[model samples]
Target chain A: MSNATNLDGAITLITGAGRGIGFGIAEVLSERGSVIAISDLDADAAGTASDAINSTGGQAAAFQGDTTSQDSMDALAAAVLQEFGHIDILVCNAGVIGAPGYQDRTEHTEADWDATFGVNVKGLVHTTNSVTPHMCERNTGRVVNIASQAGRKPRGARIALGSVQSPYTVSKAAVIQWTHLLAVELAPHNITVNAVCPGVLWTPMWETIAENQKANNPELSELTSREIFDLSINERMPMGREQTPRDIGKAVAFLASDDASEITGQALNVNGGAVMN
Target chain B: MPESSLGQLAGKVALVTGGARGIGLGIATVLVERGATVALCDLAQTACDKAVSDLGAAGHSVLGTVADVTSRDSMESAVANVNTTLGGIDILVANAGVWASEGYENRPEYNDADWDITHSVNVRGVVNATEAVIPYMKEHKRGKIVNIASHGGRKPRGTATGRTLGMPYSVSKAGVIQWTHLLAVELAPFNINVNAVCPGELWTSMIEGIFTNRQNLVGGGSGGSVRNEYDEFMQTTVPLGRGQTPRDIGKAVAFLASDDAAEITGQALNVNGGARMN
Candidate 1:
């Protein structure tokens, strides 16, 4: 109700902003008058998101950066700094849930585990490490990590036909822990670090999961993938409603705003009454 | 005090346990500032009355009630009195809590009374206050519950005075945090959002007393007062380079109590200036 989170004239860099929660965050923050830099692994998607914001009279630019590559992050930070002067906010929203692994951890391939951690855990580190020095030098910054509810609670075969193995959950848990460590480390520099745990957003990631579930089980072939996803949401989400990308984005905006100056080192759950931790 | 920028809590009735002083009073102040009528419940009538008079002089709608949070009967009675005077409670800030002074080195000698008192006020106190407000909130089908916990519950950290305050205080806070989670799950059906705010080392009388005890325990041979030791500890331990104020904790409580946090439940939000992150 209180739209006092004034981001006027601030420069915000959001990773994975081509779509989903990251794009939602970029849109809302831009509406608050912040200059946005939309970075994603997909160059065309980033360009389109940036173009859409720019067409709406909001200042925005697109950059292609892979979170898994430290060099790419550094380059992205340097380019953004060169263009916008300084970055006041960084939202680490890039993450990956590996292909459904074997039911047991022992049967899971090393590549599967590495890929999950590579994008979720190590990618977050690369982006934070690249941008924090500039923020520390300026003595002000805000970092919002988009973690998931699975990070706080074990998914444990909750999806009707879908299976979530250890790699994704463990990586998200690591992101939460890393958010804590970075929050403490950056506090002295006046940079606030926090994590947002979103629950059951109908993003491309979930669509992929739903498609995989429909394909993996022939018993559920009659039901569409979207129907299966809805069933999972109805069963797990206590609010009896699906969470939107904007819901998570609003939460990220609140944490990054000046109104939340006292809030740091906290992982706020933006779920629909699921995984209350 | 600064004017409340957002009247998000206007027309809401708030009841705060241990509202005589410290964090509870701070939370009550914020709620009242946000245009909510507040009821101050504390162990003693004198302290509650004094606090009410002080806050009343500021042109706020506030009442004082004598209630021991450790006793369910007293809490229930206090809630009844508040409902009769201020209307049904829309928000409950369970801030009543206590700490143990025994050192970890002397854990063997620590009596059962120490542990009992700590758990009674910190853990059971939250339960008593929450239970009293549930029926009123259930009738309305809407409410917000903010439990005051400590950073000690989230993770291990040195005391403000750089002394070990033992495990009872941390363990009790952990119980409070866990209780918040379980209550959030159970009460979700009633549309009551239950959350906890874990304050870091705030400069309160309770913490000042701990600092003094630590100074005395070290025999004051370091040639520094308790305040100085606390300042140094804050400088080194707290990444923010300062201890939190009561208002800091109060603002967090106000946030969770507002409709802005409707979707947030079963959360342990740390307001310790990055002392401990969970």
Candidate 2:
């Protein structure tokens, strides 16, 4: 059994903790008594999110960092470590959806693929590199990478877009595989690494996806984004319900807890059963 | 309705096939603990009665049924019994399964019997249970069907069972996973959610039996106890370096059965302490 079981009073660092799922994770973790270090590319968003947590009676600090830049991540890591004394958990939730999957397009633009990969895949690596050293120094840590159900053999899952969001989906796939590789690498250090594949949360990313889907599909042009989202939910989601950010946050919190110390190199799906692979 | 979850399956009638012991019992116990009136359906009346008694002693609502998952008629009657006795079949945990290790020596040496039994019990059994409940669920317009799968169905483990090579059991589990997908899609309009839970490296009697047999046939006087063999495999393969409890599998089944997973369908969730992740 590991001595670190709970997230109570642990110092944590989260990438892209500005809003949506990232903020959702931060809030849940903070409620669990962890001091949060919120990082985002947008300084205002990061600060506002941190402040929101603080106002909610959770300890938090804000730092501006772009996950695509290793140097920037490294600096942000240093600042967070200095401010928080140590980083017991690192949540690499910063991600991009790339281009909205259009029904008519066979593939996405190169820039879309690169941008999606840059943030979703490589961004995770950069952030992991930034925080793992401090964790390695202490010989204990937890890493939860925010992945997507789309990344896990989701080709046949219509709710996740069969041919759409390829770049984003593929990049998330890479992130999951990378989580395994990193978990193996960090397991010896007592550092558990995992991924959380959220199902269908109506976050900003999903809004974009719904908008693009409706825009690209002639039949859906008359429908609203929320309506399109609902249609996908009703037709594809067996539960016929939308997933909440809190659902994903709860999963991340579990993986980060001591109870999940034995759970590593795994991707936990928080989707409402849309994609189960 | 989707707001309820985890510990809130109260009053829901849950039927667990092969629920006398092992993983099936594990799922039944959890569902019972969560306040569902559980019907334990197994092949032997004695085993089912004992299981039901043990659960009943704990002050939970539970019943027993002697039914074979491989037989559609038996399953249909069992489902009907559950419906009449417990009011309705709200959730069905298709936990009955068979693992064929009698064949596959080096590289999947498939035996005719192994293939037949595995498919008959693991794949077709799940389908039978699901089909038996579909009419009732469709009539009720609310249901959750969770099929038991294995990590072997998704990918080969790097060690242990992986060394046994891909065989009938793996293929049969693969079928269950696929069928879950199809059923999830087909049953969506009926407000029924279908999913699969793939457990990894649990040390159940079935697993203990596998290890003992494997040691006898493969190790040839390697002098390791079954538990020792299981521990060694967990150490080498599982990143978490641990074996999962049936309770762990139960938690997953309960989650998928609850409103918490209302949007989740056709998913194969792995509950094996990171032993297998694909």
Candidate 3:
């Protein structure tokens, strides 16, 4: 599809851009003429993804930043502003599914809740706090948070995934609510904050989810991991298809664009295209 | 400045009932921007003509039809007009609505006529519009239907008087959501997905009336006093600290009509600046 909106010389900082949906967002924005600041916890992975973009004739610089640390994000934000001079967009895409042993928990522990929120929720605060002051100073910025469909809707009862992934889901719900509060606070600064809730996508995250589901669910024990993923997609997604990382990228790109400036504190679900029309 | 790239409804036809003004017109505007040939269905011929010509002057493919959602025959004729003039309808936004502001009190003890008018226009109108479009949509084997509901439908709003929102209007809107869910299931086989867009706060006549009534119930300066009250309400209750615009609701309805929301149906999506997240 031909893109009518162009970012041109926009500068965007995307957390967790080393792989998966974050990398997908980086690629799309870069295609639209954005100079990317790719920050990830894994330094080598970040460098590899940045190289991939630069090799494709896009401008991207990789930086290592641990989202779990406020000081790390603060330092990373300063380094990025120093490197790029101005930041136009920030994608809070770094997320953790659960606490370390959450997948095995029958009942979630307090540590599980704390660990999950520390990364998924507080990580966003660190990044936005470090960067939004500059945005307020300049009076221009966009913040696109990557939430999930699970945040907006409850998973069906009796689903093993629901119990195992409660922390991730709750944190995403927090992300959406936070998006609203920040949008309200930052609107005076001309900064629009929004969240994109993605549907089922084939990613490393899904790989783990599918593996666990196939092992845990009696109905899917015999099937391959891919089949299990496809089954979930068929059941959940009305279009009976899986979303690509680029599908999410398109949504993030739009939310970060100038045309959507009026849209703030909203969550746009990037699922199987609604085809409602 | 670059134009919006959110045009997923290109080459389609959209009909927005009650499209003469307010939220309906707002929805028509976005659909036209998305490259859809639009037809406005309204109760007033003059308003409809004015809306049509205004949009036409801006280089949009648009027309107007006179229809009353309370009258099935009137709606069917409007849908037929769209079919004959625009070829087919791929999208329908059932947006005609009325608040319980006529000859009634604002409290729970609102009079009988208000109840009749509320259900007649808000509830029956949505059903009429939806029923009129379904057959045509079924023939095409695909359609998107969006009903314009309100945040009042999901929860009971408050006034400084400690009185609740207009009960009849709120109840009718809730009924609209119920119908949307039911229609989604009934129409899914025909490739028709139905959803309700529950708008939060907007500065329309409907909202103006609400403010006027609130002032009547509890004095907020003059009966016309609303600016300060609106700001206070937004800052206090809404997380986004702002009222939604008609265009904001329009964008949401357009998205629901587009391929991006194909997975959504039988759902009441809130577009109220996070006023109500669930």
Candidate 1 chain B, poorest ten consecutive residues by summed lDDT? B101-110
RMSD of 3: 4.1
* Chain A of model 3 scored by TM-score: 0.94
Error of 1 at B43 (Å): 2.7
**C-alpha positional error of residue B41 in candidate 2 after TM-score superposition, expressed in Å:** 2.6
Local distance difference test values of all predictions, in order: 0.82, 0.80, 0.80
Compute fnat per model: 0.40, 0.33, 0.11
Taking the candidates in order, what DockQ does each have?
A: 0.32, 0.29, 0.23
Per residue, candidate 1 scores C-alpha lDDT tens digits across A1-277 of: 2333557888999999999888988887887778999999999999999999999878999999999999999999999999999999999999876745432223336776888899999999999999999999999999999888888866455553333446777899999999888888888899999999988878888776676666666765688867977888778866566777777766776687766777788888877667865
Clashes of 3: 8
In candidate 3, position B196 carries an lDDT of 87
Candidate 3 ranges with C-alpha deviation above 4 Å: A1-9, A28-35, A51-59, A99-115, A152-156, A161-163, A180-190, A257-263, A271-277, B1-8, B104-109, B156-161, B181-193, B222-242, B260-269, B273-278
| CAPRI-style class, candidate 1 | acceptable
Q: Candidate 1: where are CA atoms >4 Å away? A: A1-9, A30-33, A47-61, A99-111, A153-164, A258-263, B1-6, B53-59, B100-109, B155-165, B220-222
Error of 1 at A14 (Å): 1.2
lDDT of 1 at A19: 92
lDDT of 1: 0.82
The candidate, 1 or 3, that scores higher on TM-score is 1
